[model samples]
Target: MKYALKRIFMLVLTMVIVSFLTFLAFELISGDPAEAMLGTEATPERLAALREELGLNRPFLVRYASWLAGFVSGDLGVSLRYRQPVWDLIAPKLEITLCLCLASFVLITAVSIPLAIWSYRWTGTVFEAVRTAFNQLCMAVPPFFTGILMTYLFGIVLRLFVPGDFPDLHTRFGEAMVHLFFAAVCLGIPRTAMTVRMMRSTVISEMQKAYVRTAISRGNDRHAVLTRHVLKNSLTSAITFLGQTMAELIGGSVVVEQVFGIPGLGRLLVYSISTRDYPVVQTVVVILAFWVVLAGTLADLINQQVDPRLRLGGAA
Candidate 1:
């Protein structure tokens, strides 16, 4: 209970800091929301009205306070670009982005873990050399590159799947699967390479520990030694990687979404930024920050369980 409470408090503190920084950063940027709304030829009266309408005429601190209050109450305000409630504009797109992130994560873990375990088992061989080469190549290629390659091959030349945008799963699961699978693969390839490398390193490190040596000395089989002693320890590092990946996924999805024309948060964010929609951008940044902090918190809690030194009581 105490640990959970501490986490919640820290989450709140982190959000407060994020909000303050976002506010300050946007304020420093050129172009006011009112000016963006009224245009350069506007009369002073129209400018004053626009400011009053958007509550921009208020003192900075007061405006921040009011906005924060509304945010806490689930009202993120209206977007100047979309002319709709920020949540209304964001919620539908968020679903798609969240699904994309989740799909990428699942695919990454599924492929990386087995390859990592394989790499650990078959260390120092031609197989290991091949794995190293493959991972290195994947690490070198960016997600956008992979996305484009997939689109060109499977989507364009072969005509195996649609090029961009997700399909309706409700009507046709098959087509939806094709779109999602391509997207997931594009996003997951680089992530899988990075994750596999980290997991393999962690597995190697854990296998060299005294506990693992003890298990091996007890006549335990390789499978038993790995499953019983090493997997959990290795996963701690993987979990941390996944959390950081979560943060990157939200931002990185922009490229993939745009390349494919997917209606996701990444595309929405791109649109908002291009139009200088301050409210939409600010709200999205805050939301992304919350997800990032939450992911970190989850990783910390899991790490505490796997590694006793991370616990508050420092249990062994």
Candidate 2:
């Protein structure tokens, strides 16, 4: 209970810091948002009036406090570009990003974990060598490159899915997933390479530990030992590794989303940034930061459960 509480507190603190830094960084950016909004008509008096209306003329701390308060109360403010409630705009876009990320994560975990276990058993064999080389090549390939290739081969040549057919998940969940699956594949492949490699190495290393040797000396079957003890123990590192990689997954999905023309948070963020729509950009960034922090927290809790040594008041 205490450990979970500690993690929850840290999560909230991390979010507060993230929100503050997000606001502060935008405040520090060179351009004037009000000027950008007004454009050619942004004369001195007009710009000042617009800034005051948007509360941009207020002291930095006061504005941040007001924004933060509104944020906590679920009022994320309005989008300067869309001229709509930020929540209304983000709510739909967020569904797409979340579905993409979730699908990619599922693909990564489904492939990587089993591949790692299989490769661990075949270490130094011809198959292992080929698998390692394949993963290395995949890792070398950037997400955008992979996305382009996938788009060409699947979208253009095979016509497996349309490049810009990202349907609204809310209205067409089935059809939407068909298009999202391809985009997710492009986003997940490189990350799957990293995860598989990490899992294989960690399992191999765990097999050489003193505890494994002790279990073997107690007459446990080698296969049983590796399956029940070694793999379970080794997944701790892989889980932590995957958790850390969640940020990359999100970042990479941004590029993949563009290549595939998915209307995800990444695409929205790019559009928002280009249009000087600070509210939308900041909201997307803050939401992403929250996911990263939550992933880390979940990884920690799982690690504690996996290894008794990590549990509070448990074996050292």
- How well does each candidate superpose onto the true structure, as a TM-score? 0.93, 0.94
Across 1-316, the per-residue lDDT of candidate 1 in tens digits comes to: 4666687789899999999899888888948788887788999889998888888877989988988999999899999977899988998788778878888878887888988899888797889889899899998898888888888998899987777656765576678667767777888788888988999999988888999888989999999999988997788889889888877777778788777667788888888899999889998999899989988888777777777666764233
Model 1, which residues run further than 4 Å from truth? 158-160, 168-174, 313-316
Residue 176, model 1: lDDT of 69
How large is the C-alpha RMSD of every model relative to the true structure? 2.0, 1.9
Cα lDDT tens digits for candidate 2, 1-316: 5777788899999999999999999889837887888887668999898888888878999989999998888889888887798989998878888888888998998899988888887887899888888999989988788888888898899987788877778787887898888888888888899898888888878888999989999999978898889988988898888888776678778888899989888888898988989998888889989999999998888888888777764234
* Least well predicted 10-residue stretch by lDDT in candidate 2: 307-316
Pairs that collide, model 2 = none
Candidate 1 CA-lDDT value? 0.84
